[model samples]
Target: MSESEKAARLSVFKTYKLFVGGKFPRSESGRVYEVTDSKGRWLANAPQSSRKDARDAVVAARKAFAGWSGATAYNRGQILYRVAEMLEGRRDQFVREVGDAEGLSKSKAGAVVDAAIDRWVWYAGWTDKIAQIVGGANPVAGPYFNLSSPEPTGVVAILAPQESSFLGLVSVVAPVIATGNTAVVVTSEASPLPALSLGEVLATSDLPGGVVNLLSGRTAEIATPLAAHQDVNAIDLAGAEEVLAKELEIAAADNLKRVRRPQPVDWAADPGTERLTSFLETKTVWHPAGGSGSSGAAY
Candidate 1:
Protein backbone atom coordinates (compact mmCIF):
# COMPACT_ATOMS: atom_id res chain seq x y z
CA MET A 1 0.00 0.00 0.00
CA SER A 2 1.12 3.58 -0.71
CA GLU A 3 2.12 5.92 2.16
CA SER A 4 -1.15 7.85 1.87
CA GLU A 5 -3.24 4.71 2.08
CA LYS A 6 -1.09 3.02 4.76
CA ALA A 7 -0.96 5.99 7.19
CA ALA A 8 -4.05 6.19 9.41
CA ARG A 9 -5.62 9.54 10.20
CA LEU A 10 -5.23 10.75 13.80
CA SER A 11 -8.47 11.17 15.74
CA VAL A 12 -9.06 14.68 16.95
CA PHE A 13 -9.94 14.64 20.67
CA LYS A 14 -12.60 16.97 22.06
CA THR A 15 -11.60 19.37 24.80
CA TYR A 16 -14.33 19.28 27.41
CA LYS A 17 -14.75 22.62 29.08
CA LEU A 18 -17.08 24.21 31.60
CA PHE A 19 -20.11 26.02 30.18
CA VAL A 20 -20.27 29.36 31.93
CA GLY A 21 -22.00 32.53 30.77
CA GLY A 22 -22.79 30.72 27.50
CA LYS A 23 -19.11 30.35 26.77
CA PHE A 24 -16.87 27.29 26.99
CA PRO A 25 -14.00 27.91 29.38
CA ARG A 26 -11.37 25.77 30.96
CA SER A 27 -11.62 25.68 34.73
CA GLU A 28 -10.36 28.79 36.48
CA SER A 29 -7.88 26.54 38.28
CA GLY A 30 -6.90 25.00 34.93
CA ARG A 31 -7.48 21.48 36.18
CA VAL A 32 -8.96 18.47 34.42
CA TYR A 33 -9.78 14.96 35.58
CA GLU A 34 -10.20 11.84 33.51
CA VAL A 35 -13.82 10.86 32.89
CA THR A 36 -14.28 7.16 32.43
CA ASP A 37 -16.88 4.78 31.17
CA SER A 38 -18.72 2.36 33.46
CA LYS A 39 -15.99 -0.21 33.01
CA GLY A 40 -13.26 2.28 33.98
CA ARG A 41 -12.10 2.99 30.44
CA TRP A 42 -11.16 6.61 29.88
CA LEU A 43 -13.65 8.49 27.76
CA ALA A 44 -12.19 11.98 28.02
CA ASN A 45 -10.84 14.61 30.36
CA ALA A 46 -13.54 16.83 31.91
CA PRO A 47 -12.80 20.19 33.47
CA GLN A 48 -12.24 20.02 37.22
CA SER A 49 -14.22 23.08 38.18
CA SER A 50 -12.89 25.05 41.15
CA ARG A 51 -14.55 27.06 43.91
CA LYS A 52 -13.88 30.16 41.84
CA ASP A 53 -15.55 28.46 38.92
CA ALA A 54 -18.61 27.70 41.02
CA ARG A 55 -18.73 31.31 42.17
CA ASP A 56 -18.42 32.45 38.56
CA ALA A 57 -21.31 30.23 37.57
CA VAL A 58 -23.40 31.80 40.33
CA VAL A 59 -22.53 35.23 39.02
CA ALA A 60 -23.68 34.20 35.57
CA ALA A 61 -26.87 32.62 36.82
CA ARG A 62 -27.71 35.62 38.95
CA LYS A 63 -27.07 37.99 36.09
CA ALA A 64 -29.35 36.02 33.77
CA PHE A 65 -32.12 35.46 36.33
CA ALA A 66 -33.85 38.80 35.88
CA GLY A 67 -34.33 38.47 32.15
CA TRP A 68 -35.21 34.82 32.36
CA SER A 69 -37.65 35.28 35.21
CA GLY A 70 -39.22 38.30 33.56
CA ALA A 71 -39.90 36.48 30.32
CA THR A 72 -43.50 35.47 29.73
CA ALA A 73 -44.33 31.88 30.57
CA TYR A 74 -45.40 31.19 27.02
CA ASN A 75 -42.06 32.40 25.71
CA ARG A 76 -40.23 30.28 28.26
CA GLY A 77 -42.21 27.23 27.16
CA GLN A 78 -41.28 27.94 23.57
CA ILE A 79 -37.60 28.03 24.46
CA LEU A 80 -37.77 24.81 26.47
CA TYR A 81 -39.68 23.07 23.71
CA ARG A 82 -36.99 24.20 21.33
CA VAL A 83 -34.48 22.50 23.62
CA ALA A 84 -36.44 19.26 23.32
CA GLU A 85 -36.34 19.61 19.56
CA MET A 86 -32.58 20.06 19.61
CA LEU A 87 -32.11 17.08 21.90
CA GLU A 88 -34.28 14.98 19.63
CA GLY A 89 -32.13 15.87 16.65
CA ARG A 90 -29.03 14.73 18.53
CA ARG A 91 -30.54 11.55 19.93
CA ASP A 92 -27.94 9.14 18.63
CA GLN A 93 -25.05 11.01 20.18
CA PHE A 94 -26.70 11.07 23.62
CA VAL A 95 -27.51 7.40 23.31
CA ARG A 96 -23.86 6.55 22.90
CA GLU A 97 -22.86 8.78 25.78
CA VAL A 98 -25.48 7.41 28.08
CA GLY A 99 -24.62 3.84 27.14
CA ASP A 100 -20.99 4.37 27.96
CA ALA A 101 -21.64 6.32 31.12
CA GLU A 102 -24.26 4.00 32.54
CA GLY A 103 -23.09 0.62 31.28
CA LEU A 104 -26.17 -0.03 29.26
CA SER A 105 -26.79 -1.55 25.87
CA LYS A 106 -27.35 0.69 22.84
CA SER A 107 -31.10 0.10 22.94
CA LYS A 108 -31.29 0.79 26.65
CA ALA A 109 -29.24 3.95 26.30
CA GLY A 110 -31.47 5.05 23.44
CA ALA A 111 -34.47 4.56 25.70
CA VAL A 112 -32.87 6.73 28.36
CA VAL A 113 -32.13 9.46 25.84
CA ASP A 114 -35.70 9.33 24.56
CA ALA A 115 -36.92 9.67 28.14
CA ALA A 116 -34.68 12.65 28.76
CA ILE A 117 -35.93 14.43 25.64
CA ASP A 118 -39.52 13.64 26.50
CA ARG A 119 -38.91 14.89 30.02
CA TRP A 120 -37.79 18.19 28.58
CA VAL A 121 -40.95 18.34 26.49
CA TRP A 122 -43.06 17.49 29.51
CA TYR A 123 -41.57 20.34 31.54
CA ALA A 124 -42.03 22.62 28.56
CA GLY A 125 -45.76 21.93 28.67
CA TRP A 126 -45.85 22.92 32.35
CA THR A 127 -44.33 26.39 31.96
CA ASP A 128 -47.54 28.23 31.12
CA LYS A 129 -49.90 26.15 33.24
CA ILE A 130 -48.02 25.75 36.52
CA ALA A 131 -49.21 29.12 37.71
CA GLN A 132 -52.83 28.11 37.36
CA ILE A 133 -52.24 24.84 39.17
CA VAL A 134 -50.21 26.32 42.03
CA GLY A 135 -51.61 29.82 42.24
CA GLY A 136 -55.09 31.36 42.05
CA ALA A 137 -57.67 33.67 43.59
CA ASN A 138 -58.52 33.24 47.26
CA PRO A 139 -61.95 33.91 48.67
CA VAL A 140 -61.67 36.77 51.17
CA ALA A 141 -64.52 38.24 53.22
CA GLY A 142 -63.60 41.85 52.53
CA PRO A 143 -63.92 44.57 49.91
CA TYR A 144 -60.73 43.33 48.32
CA PHE A 145 -59.47 40.99 45.63
CA ASN A 146 -56.83 38.54 46.79
CA LEU A 147 -54.68 36.57 44.43
CA SER A 148 -51.47 34.57 44.59
CA SER A 149 -48.87 33.94 41.94
CA PRO A 150 -45.79 31.77 41.73
CA GLU A 151 -42.45 33.41 41.03
CA PRO A 152 -39.01 32.05 40.28
CA THR A 153 -36.62 31.66 43.21
CA GLY A 154 -33.57 33.04 41.38
CA VAL A 155 -30.29 31.10 41.18
CA VAL A 156 -30.40 27.42 42.11
CA ALA A 157 -27.51 24.99 42.58
CA ILE A 158 -28.09 21.40 41.54
CA LEU A 159 -26.01 18.26 42.07
CA ALA A 160 -26.65 15.98 39.11
CA PRO A 161 -27.37 12.38 40.09
CA GLN A 162 -24.40 10.05 39.82
CA GLU A 163 -26.12 6.85 38.79
CA SER A 164 -28.41 7.91 35.98
CA SER A 165 -26.19 10.58 34.42
CA PHE A 166 -28.02 12.00 31.39
CA LEU A 167 -31.59 11.15 32.35
CA GLY A 168 -31.18 12.23 35.96
CA LEU A 169 -29.33 15.36 34.99
CA VAL A 170 -32.12 16.44 32.65
CA SER A 171 -34.74 15.57 35.25
CA VAL A 172 -33.17 17.95 37.76
CA VAL A 173 -32.24 20.78 35.40
CA ALA A 174 -35.20 21.12 32.98
CA PRO A 175 -37.62 21.94 35.80
CA VAL A 176 -35.56 24.76 37.35
CA ILE A 177 -35.26 26.64 34.06
CA ALA A 178 -38.81 25.77 33.09
CA THR A 179 -40.02 27.70 36.13
CA GLY A 180 -37.84 30.71 35.22
CA ASN A 181 -35.05 29.99 37.71
CA THR A 182 -31.43 29.91 36.55
CA ALA A 183 -29.19 27.01 37.63
CA VAL A 184 -25.57 26.09 38.38
CA VAL A 185 -25.30 22.34 37.90
CA VAL A 186 -22.40 20.16 39.08
CA THR A 187 -22.27 17.12 36.83
CA SER A 188 -21.87 13.53 38.06
CA GLU A 189 -18.41 12.99 39.52
CA ALA A 190 -17.69 9.70 37.82
CA SER A 191 -19.65 10.35 34.62
CA PRO A 192 -19.48 13.95 33.50
CA LEU A 193 -18.93 13.67 29.77
CA PRO A 194 -22.63 13.38 28.95
CA ALA A 195 -23.45 16.38 31.13
CA LEU A 196 -20.71 18.47 29.49
CA SER A 197 -22.05 17.41 26.11
CA LEU A 198 -25.47 18.57 27.28
CA GLY A 199 -24.07 22.07 27.69
CA GLU A 200 -23.36 22.10 23.95
CA VAL A 201 -27.01 21.24 23.26
CA LEU A 202 -28.24 23.98 25.63
CA ALA A 203 -25.94 26.51 24.00
CA THR A 204 -27.42 25.79 20.59
CA SER A 205 -30.98 25.94 21.85
CA ASP A 206 -32.92 29.17 22.32
CA LEU A 207 -32.16 29.05 26.03
CA PRO A 208 -30.17 32.13 27.04
CA GLY A 209 -26.59 32.00 28.26
CA GLY A 210 -26.16 31.70 32.05
CA VAL A 211 -29.66 30.26 32.20
CA VAL A 212 -27.99 26.90 32.81
CA ASN A 213 -24.29 26.82 33.66
CA LEU A 214 -22.61 23.40 33.66
CA LEU A 215 -19.70 22.48 35.94
CA SER A 216 -17.82 19.23 36.27
CA GLY A 217 -15.62 18.28 39.20
CA ARG A 218 -15.63 16.70 42.64
CA THR A 219 -19.28 17.03 43.73
CA ALA A 220 -18.45 17.94 47.31
CA GLU A 221 -15.94 20.59 46.35
CA ILE A 222 -18.25 22.26 43.83
CA ALA A 223 -21.36 22.04 45.98
CA THR A 224 -19.96 23.44 49.25
CA PRO A 225 -19.63 27.03 48.11
CA LEU A 226 -22.92 26.96 46.21
CA ALA A 227 -24.82 25.86 49.28
CA ALA A 228 -23.47 28.81 51.20
CA HIS A 229 -23.57 31.44 48.48
CA GLN A 230 -25.64 34.36 49.65
CA ASP A 231 -26.84 35.06 46.13
CA VAL A 232 -27.98 31.51 45.52
CA ASN A 233 -31.64 31.08 46.45
CA ALA A 234 -31.93 27.32 46.54
CA ILE A 235 -30.14 23.96 46.19
CA ASP A 236 -31.03 20.40 45.20
CA LEU A 237 -28.86 17.71 46.76
CA ALA A 238 -29.92 14.84 44.56
CA GLY A 239 -26.36 13.73 43.96
CA ALA A 240 -24.97 14.35 47.43
CA GLU A 241 -24.29 11.51 49.78
CA GLU A 242 -25.89 11.38 53.22
CA VAL A 243 -23.07 13.08 55.09
CA LEU A 244 -22.46 15.70 52.43
CA ALA A 245 -26.15 16.43 52.09
CA LYS A 246 -26.38 17.01 55.83
CA GLU A 247 -23.38 19.31 55.78
CA LEU A 248 -24.64 21.28 52.80
CA GLU A 249 -28.09 21.56 54.32
CA ILE A 250 -26.56 23.23 57.36
CA ALA A 251 -24.63 25.65 55.21
CA ALA A 252 -27.77 26.45 53.20
CA ALA A 253 -29.47 27.42 56.46
CA ASP A 254 -26.99 30.28 56.85
CA ASN A 255 -28.86 32.17 54.15
CA LEU A 256 -32.15 30.33 54.57
CA LYS A 257 -31.71 28.93 51.08
CA ARG A 258 -34.36 26.50 49.93
CA VAL A 259 -33.06 22.98 50.16
CA ARG A 260 -34.21 19.80 48.45
CA ARG A 261 -32.63 16.94 50.32
CA PRO A 262 -31.31 13.87 48.61
CA GLN A 263 -33.92 11.21 48.05
CA PRO A 264 -34.16 7.90 46.25
CA VAL A 265 -35.66 8.68 42.89
CA ASP A 266 -36.48 6.66 39.84
CA TRP A 267 -35.18 8.86 37.05
CA ALA A 268 -37.17 7.11 34.33
CA ALA A 269 -40.48 7.35 36.12
CA ASP A 270 -43.05 10.11 35.73
CA PRO A 271 -41.68 13.17 37.52
CA GLY A 272 -44.46 15.30 38.90
CA THR A 273 -44.52 19.04 39.55
CA GLU A 274 -42.54 18.76 42.79
CA ARG A 275 -39.20 19.61 41.20
CA LEU A 276 -40.84 22.50 39.35
CA THR A 277 -42.34 23.92 42.53
CA SER A 278 -39.36 23.35 44.79
CA PHE A 279 -37.60 26.50 43.63
CA LEU A 280 -40.66 28.74 43.25
CA GLU A 281 -41.89 31.31 45.73
CA THR A 282 -45.45 32.49 46.07
CA LYS A 283 -46.33 36.16 45.93
CA THR A 284 -49.78 37.01 47.18
CA VAL A 285 -51.43 40.34 46.41
CA TRP A 286 -54.41 42.01 48.08
CA HIS A 287 -56.01 44.77 46.04
CA PRO A 288 -58.98 46.81 47.14
CA ALA A 289 -62.15 46.20 45.15
CA GLY A 290 -62.53 49.29 43.00
CA GLY A 291 -63.82 50.93 39.91
CA SER A 292 -61.69 53.46 38.01
CA GLY A 293 -62.66 56.19 40.48
CA SER A 294 -62.09 54.06 43.60
CA SER A 295 -59.07 54.37 45.88
CA GLY A 296 -56.06 52.49 44.51
CA ALA A 297 -55.14 51.04 47.91
CA ALA A 298 -53.55 47.62 48.45
CA TYR A 299 -53.73 46.08 51.93
Candidate 2:
Protein backbone atom coordinates (compact mmCIF):
# COMPACT_ATOMS: atom_id res chain seq x y z
CA MET A 1 0.00 0.00 0.00
CA SER A 2 1.32 3.42 -1.01
CA GLU A 3 -0.03 6.96 -0.86
CA SER A 4 -1.74 6.97 -4.31
CA GLU A 5 -0.26 3.53 -4.97
CA LYS A 6 -0.33 2.36 -1.32
CA ALA A 7 -3.49 4.26 -0.30
CA ALA A 8 -6.68 2.86 1.19
CA ARG A 9 -9.74 3.39 -0.91
CA LEU A 10 -12.85 4.96 0.55
CA SER A 11 -15.51 2.49 1.58
CA VAL A 12 -18.72 2.33 -0.36
CA PHE A 13 -21.76 3.32 1.68
CA LYS A 14 -25.09 1.54 1.37
CA THR A 15 -28.28 3.50 0.70
CA TYR A 16 -31.16 2.04 2.64
CA LYS A 17 -34.66 2.33 1.17
CA LEU A 18 -38.14 1.80 2.57
CA PHE A 19 -39.85 -1.57 2.15
CA VAL A 20 -43.39 -1.21 0.85
CA GLY A 21 -45.47 -3.63 -1.15
CA GLY A 22 -42.49 -5.98 -1.54
CA LYS A 23 -40.59 -3.23 -3.30
CA PHE A 24 -37.62 -1.09 -2.25
CA PRO A 25 -38.59 2.48 -2.95
CA ARG A 26 -37.28 5.87 -2.05
CA SER A 27 -39.73 7.85 0.02
CA GLU A 28 -42.21 9.43 -2.35
CA SER A 29 -41.39 12.67 -0.64
CA GLY A 30 -37.73 12.14 -1.64
CA ARG A 31 -36.81 12.66 1.99
CA VAL A 32 -34.02 10.79 3.79
CA TYR A 33 -32.30 11.02 7.15
CA GLU A 34 -28.81 10.20 8.33
CA VAL A 35 -28.69 6.92 10.21
CA THR A 36 -25.75 6.56 12.55
CA ASP A 37 -24.23 3.71 14.50
CA SER A 38 -24.15 3.73 18.29
CA LYS A 39 -20.80 5.50 18.20
CA GLY A 40 -22.37 8.17 15.95
CA ARG A 41 -20.55 6.96 12.85
CA TRP A 42 -22.53 7.61 9.70
CA LEU A 43 -24.06 4.38 8.49
CA ALA A 44 -26.40 5.45 5.70
CA ASN A 45 -29.36 7.61 4.80
CA ALA A 46 -32.63 5.90 5.55
CA PRO A 47 -35.91 6.90 3.97
CA GLN A 48 -37.74 9.51 6.03
CA SER A 49 -41.17 8.22 5.23
CA SER A 50 -44.09 10.62 4.98
CA ARG A 51 -47.80 10.42 5.78
CA LYS A 52 -48.57 9.80 2.11
CA ASP A 53 -46.20 6.89 2.31
CA ALA A 54 -48.06 5.60 5.32
CA ARG A 55 -51.37 5.87 3.52
CA ASP A 56 -49.92 4.13 0.51
CA ALA A 57 -48.67 1.31 2.73
CA VAL A 58 -52.10 0.97 4.31
CA VAL A 59 -53.68 0.82 0.89
CA ALA A 60 -51.28 -1.86 -0.19
CA ALA A 61 -51.88 -3.87 2.97
CA ARG A 62 -55.66 -3.66 2.62
CA LYS A 63 -55.42 -4.71 -1.02
CA ALA A 64 -53.38 -7.76 -0.17
CA PHE A 65 -55.34 -8.78 2.91
CA ALA A 66 -58.06 -10.85 1.28
CA GLY A 67 -55.69 -13.07 -0.67
CA TRP A 68 -53.24 -13.46 2.18
CA SER A 69 -55.94 -14.12 4.73
CA GLY A 70 -57.68 -16.55 2.43
CA ALA A 71 -54.57 -18.60 1.80
CA THR A 72 -54.45 -22.00 3.45
CA ALA A 73 -53.03 -21.84 6.95
CA TYR A 74 -50.43 -24.45 6.06
CA ASN A 75 -49.28 -22.30 3.17
CA ARG A 76 -49.03 -19.27 5.40
CA GLY A 77 -47.01 -21.30 7.88
CA GLN A 78 -44.60 -22.35 5.14
CA ILE A 79 -44.17 -18.75 4.03
CA LEU A 80 -43.42 -17.68 7.59
CA TYR A 81 -40.94 -20.54 7.97
CA ARG A 82 -39.32 -19.33 4.78
CA VAL A 83 -38.81 -15.95 6.43
CA ALA A 84 -36.83 -17.69 9.15
CA GLU A 85 -34.84 -19.55 6.53
CA MET A 86 -34.01 -16.34 4.71
CA LEU A 87 -32.94 -14.68 7.93
CA GLU A 88 -30.69 -17.64 8.73
CA GLY A 89 -28.93 -17.34 5.38
CA ARG A 90 -28.25 -13.68 6.11
CA ARG A 91 -27.27 -14.22 9.74
CA ASP A 92 -23.93 -12.45 9.77
CA GLN A 93 -25.34 -9.33 8.16
CA PHE A 94 -27.95 -9.06 10.91
CA VAL A 95 -25.35 -9.73 13.61
CA ARG A 96 -23.25 -6.85 12.35
CA GLU A 97 -26.17 -4.48 11.97
CA VAL A 98 -27.59 -5.37 15.35
CA GLY A 99 -24.25 -4.84 17.02
CA ASP A 100 -23.79 -1.49 15.34
CA ALA A 101 -27.29 -0.18 15.84
CA GLU A 102 -27.75 -1.30 19.45
CA GLY A 103 -24.13 -0.98 20.61
CA LEU A 104 -24.10 -4.57 21.75
CA SER A 105 -21.11 -6.88 21.97
CA LYS A 106 -20.84 -9.29 19.05
CA SER A 107 -22.14 -12.14 21.24
CA LYS A 108 -25.04 -10.08 22.49
CA ALA A 109 -25.90 -8.98 18.99
CA GLY A 110 -25.73 -12.57 17.84
CA ALA A 111 -28.12 -13.59 20.59
CA VAL A 112 -30.59 -10.91 19.50
CA VAL A 113 -30.36 -12.06 15.93
CA ASP A 114 -30.87 -15.66 16.97
CA ALA A 115 -33.86 -14.75 19.06
CA ALA A 116 -35.42 -12.82 16.19
CA ILE A 117 -35.10 -15.82 13.88
CA ASP A 118 -36.56 -18.15 16.48
CA ARG A 119 -39.43 -15.75 17.07
CA TRP A 120 -40.38 -16.00 13.42
CA VAL A 121 -40.26 -19.79 13.61
CA TRP A 122 -42.43 -19.80 16.69
CA TYR A 123 -45.04 -17.62 15.03
CA ALA A 124 -44.83 -19.76 11.91
CA GLY A 125 -46.04 -22.79 13.84
CA TRP A 126 -48.85 -20.78 15.33
CA THR A 127 -50.39 -19.86 11.96
CA ASP A 128 -52.14 -23.17 11.54
CA LYS A 129 -52.87 -23.96 15.18
CA ILE A 130 -54.28 -20.70 16.56
CA ALA A 131 -57.77 -21.32 15.23
CA GLN A 132 -57.97 -24.61 17.00
CA ILE A 133 -56.84 -23.25 20.35
CA VAL A 134 -58.95 -20.08 20.39
CA GLY A 135 -62.14 -21.56 19.02
CA GLY A 136 -64.39 -24.56 19.58
CA ALA A 137 -67.90 -25.96 19.63
CA ASN A 138 -70.17 -24.31 22.23
CA PRO A 139 -72.64 -26.29 24.28
CA VAL A 140 -76.15 -24.83 23.95
CA ALA A 141 -79.48 -25.73 25.58
CA GLY A 142 -81.29 -25.75 22.24
CA PRO A 143 -80.92 -28.33 19.44
CA TYR A 144 -78.41 -26.18 17.58
CA PHE A 145 -74.82 -26.73 16.53
CA ASN A 146 -72.72 -23.69 17.40
CA LEU A 147 -69.05 -23.16 16.70
CA SER A 148 -66.62 -20.28 16.81
CA SER A 149 -63.33 -19.56 15.01
CA PRO A 150 -60.80 -16.81 14.72
CA GLU A 151 -60.51 -14.49 11.73
CA PRO A 152 -58.05 -11.79 10.81
CA THR A 153 -59.16 -8.23 11.50
CA GLY A 154 -57.55 -6.92 8.30
CA VAL A 155 -54.82 -4.30 8.02
CA VAL A 156 -52.93 -3.67 11.27
CA ALA A 157 -50.51 -0.88 12.15
CA ILE A 158 -47.59 -1.77 14.41
CA LEU A 159 -45.40 0.65 16.30
CA ALA A 160 -42.24 -1.35 16.87
CA PRO A 161 -40.35 -1.04 20.17
CA GLN A 162 -37.68 1.65 20.17
CA GLU A 163 -35.17 0.04 22.56
CA SER A 164 -34.70 -3.58 21.53
CA SER A 165 -34.66 -2.91 17.83
CA PHE A 166 -34.26 -6.30 16.18
CA LEU A 167 -35.88 -8.58 18.73
CA GLY A 168 -38.70 -6.21 19.47
CA LEU A 169 -39.42 -5.59 15.83
CA VAL A 170 -39.66 -9.31 15.16
CA SER A 171 -41.78 -9.94 18.23
CA VAL A 172 -44.37 -7.38 17.17
CA VAL A 173 -44.49 -8.13 13.46
CA ALA A 174 -44.52 -11.96 13.36
CA PRO A 175 -47.65 -12.52 15.40
CA VAL A 176 -49.79 -10.02 13.48
CA ILE A 177 -49.23 -11.80 10.20
CA ALA A 178 -49.18 -15.28 11.76
CA THR A 179 -52.92 -15.08 12.29
CA GLY A 180 -53.58 -13.72 8.76
CA ASN A 181 -53.54 -9.97 9.41
CA THR A 182 -51.54 -7.78 7.06
CA ALA A 183 -49.41 -5.04 8.66
CA VAL A 184 -47.76 -1.69 8.21
CA VAL A 185 -44.94 -1.37 10.76
CA VAL A 186 -43.20 1.78 11.99
CA THR A 187 -39.69 0.73 12.94
CA SER A 188 -37.60 2.19 15.74
CA GLU A 189 -36.63 5.78 15.05
CA ALA A 190 -33.11 5.41 16.48
CA SER A 191 -32.17 2.02 15.00
CA PRO A 192 -34.03 0.99 11.88
CA LEU A 193 -31.31 -0.61 9.76
CA PRO A 194 -32.00 -4.15 10.90
CA ALA A 195 -35.71 -3.68 10.41
CA LEU A 196 -35.15 -2.17 6.96
CA SER A 197 -32.92 -5.11 6.08
CA LEU A 198 -35.67 -7.42 7.29
CA GLY A 199 -37.77 -6.15 4.40
CA GLU A 200 -35.24 -7.69 2.04
CA VAL A 201 -35.61 -11.04 3.75
CA LEU A 202 -39.39 -10.76 3.67
CA ALA A 203 -39.35 -9.86 -0.01
CA THR A 204 -37.61 -13.13 -0.81
CA SER A 205 -39.57 -15.31 1.61
CA ASP A 206 -42.66 -15.92 -0.58
CA LEU A 207 -44.77 -13.60 1.55
CA PRO A 208 -47.16 -11.69 -0.64
CA GLY A 209 -46.33 -8.12 -1.48
CA GLY A 210 -47.87 -5.67 1.00
CA VAL A 211 -48.62 -8.44 3.48
CA VAL A 212 -46.04 -6.73 5.68
CA ASN A 213 -44.91 -3.18 4.90
CA LEU A 214 -42.17 -1.48 6.97
CA LEU A 215 -41.65 2.24 7.39
CA SER A 216 -38.72 4.07 9.01
CA GLY A 217 -39.55 7.49 10.46
CA ARG A 218 -41.04 9.27 13.45
CA THR A 219 -43.57 7.03 15.25
CA ALA A 220 -46.16 9.65 16.06
CA GLU A 221 -46.08 11.06 12.56
CA ILE A 222 -46.80 7.73 10.96
CA ALA A 223 -48.90 6.14 13.70
CA THR A 224 -51.39 8.97 14.16
CA PRO A 225 -53.02 8.73 10.76
CA LEU A 226 -53.09 4.95 10.96
CA ALA A 227 -54.82 5.09 14.29
CA ALA A 228 -57.41 7.48 12.91
CA HIS A 229 -57.75 6.00 9.43
CA GLN A 230 -61.16 4.49 8.85
CA ASP A 231 -59.73 1.65 6.77
CA VAL A 232 -57.29 0.26 9.30
CA ASN A 233 -58.75 -2.53 11.38
CA ALA A 234 -56.37 -2.42 14.33
CA ILE A 235 -53.47 -0.52 15.85
CA ASP A 236 -50.84 -2.06 18.15
CA LEU A 237 -49.15 0.51 20.34
CA ALA A 238 -46.67 -1.91 21.82
CA GLY A 239 -43.72 0.47 21.54
CA ALA A 240 -45.22 3.79 22.60
CA GLU A 241 -44.83 5.64 25.85
CA GLU A 242 -47.83 5.65 28.19
CA VAL A 243 -49.08 9.09 27.25
CA LEU A 244 -48.59 8.64 23.52
CA ALA A 245 -50.20 5.20 23.62
CA LYS A 246 -53.22 6.65 25.37
CA GLU A 247 -53.55 9.41 22.81
CA LEU A 248 -53.32 6.99 19.90
CA GLU A 249 -55.89 4.72 21.56
CA ILE A 250 -58.33 7.60 21.70
CA ALA A 251 -57.65 8.39 18.06
CA ALA A 252 -58.22 4.75 17.16
CA ALA A 253 -61.72 5.13 18.54
CA ASP A 254 -62.53 7.48 15.65
CA ASN A 255 -62.92 4.42 13.46
CA LEU A 256 -63.62 1.94 16.21
CA LYS A 257 -60.29 0.23 15.42
CA ARG A 258 -59.18 -2.55 17.68
CA VAL A 259 -56.62 -0.97 19.96
CA ARG A 260 -53.87 -2.76 21.87
CA ARG A 261 -52.27 -0.68 24.59
CA PRO A 262 -48.60 -0.85 25.44
CA GLN A 263 -47.70 -3.33 28.15
CA PRO A 264 -44.52 -4.00 30.10
CA VAL A 265 -42.81 -6.42 27.80
CA ASP A 266 -39.47 -8.16 27.69
CA TRP A 267 -38.94 -9.10 24.08
CA ALA A 268 -36.52 -11.84 25.11
CA ALA A 269 -39.13 -13.57 27.22
CA ASP A 270 -41.47 -16.25 25.96
CA PRO A 271 -44.38 -14.48 24.20
CA GLY A 272 -47.49 -16.55 24.17
CA THR A 273 -50.42 -16.28 21.70
CA GLU A 274 -51.65 -13.02 23.12
CA ARG A 275 -50.22 -10.99 20.26
CA LEU A 276 -51.85 -13.31 17.78
CA THR A 277 -55.20 -13.09 19.52
CA SER A 278 -55.15 -9.33 19.88
CA PHE A 279 -55.78 -8.76 16.18
CA LEU A 280 -58.19 -11.61 15.71
CA GLU A 281 -61.98 -11.45 15.56
CA THR A 282 -64.10 -14.36 16.64
CA LYS A 283 -66.90 -15.57 14.35
CA THR A 284 -69.66 -17.80 15.56
CA VAL A 285 -72.08 -19.83 13.49
CA TRP A 286 -75.23 -21.61 14.64
CA HIS A 287 -77.43 -24.16 12.82
CA PRO A 288 -80.42 -26.24 13.86
CA ALA A 289 -79.44 -29.89 14.34
CA GLY A 290 -82.75 -31.36 13.30
CA GLY A 291 -85.66 -31.00 10.84
CA SER A 292 -85.38 -30.13 7.13
CA GLY A 293 -83.14 -27.15 8.08
CA SER A 294 -85.17 -24.66 5.98
CA SER A 295 -85.23 -21.19 7.57
CA GLY A 296 -84.23 -22.92 10.79
CA ALA A 297 -80.70 -21.59 11.37
CA ALA A 298 -80.13 -20.15 14.86
CA TYR A 299 -78.89 -16.60 15.22
Runs in model 1 deviating more than 4 A are: 1-7, 290-299
Local accuracy of candidate 2 as per-residue lDDT tens digits, 184-230: 99999989999999999999999999999999988888888888888
Tell how far residue 282 is off in model 2, in angstroms: 0.2
RMSD in Å for model 2: 2.8
The worst-scoring run of ten residues by lDDT in candidate 1 lies at 290-299
- Model 2 has an lDDT value of 0.93
| 212 Cα displacement, candidate 2 (Å) | 0.4
Each prediction's TM-score versus the true structure: 0.95, 0.94
For residues 1-299, could you state the per-residue lDDT of candidate 1 as single tens digits? 67887677667899998999999999999999998899999999999999999999999999999999999999999999999998999899899999999999999999999999999999999999999999999999977789999999999999999898999999999999999999999999999988999999999997899999999999999999999999999999999999999999999999999999999999989999999999999999998774535565444
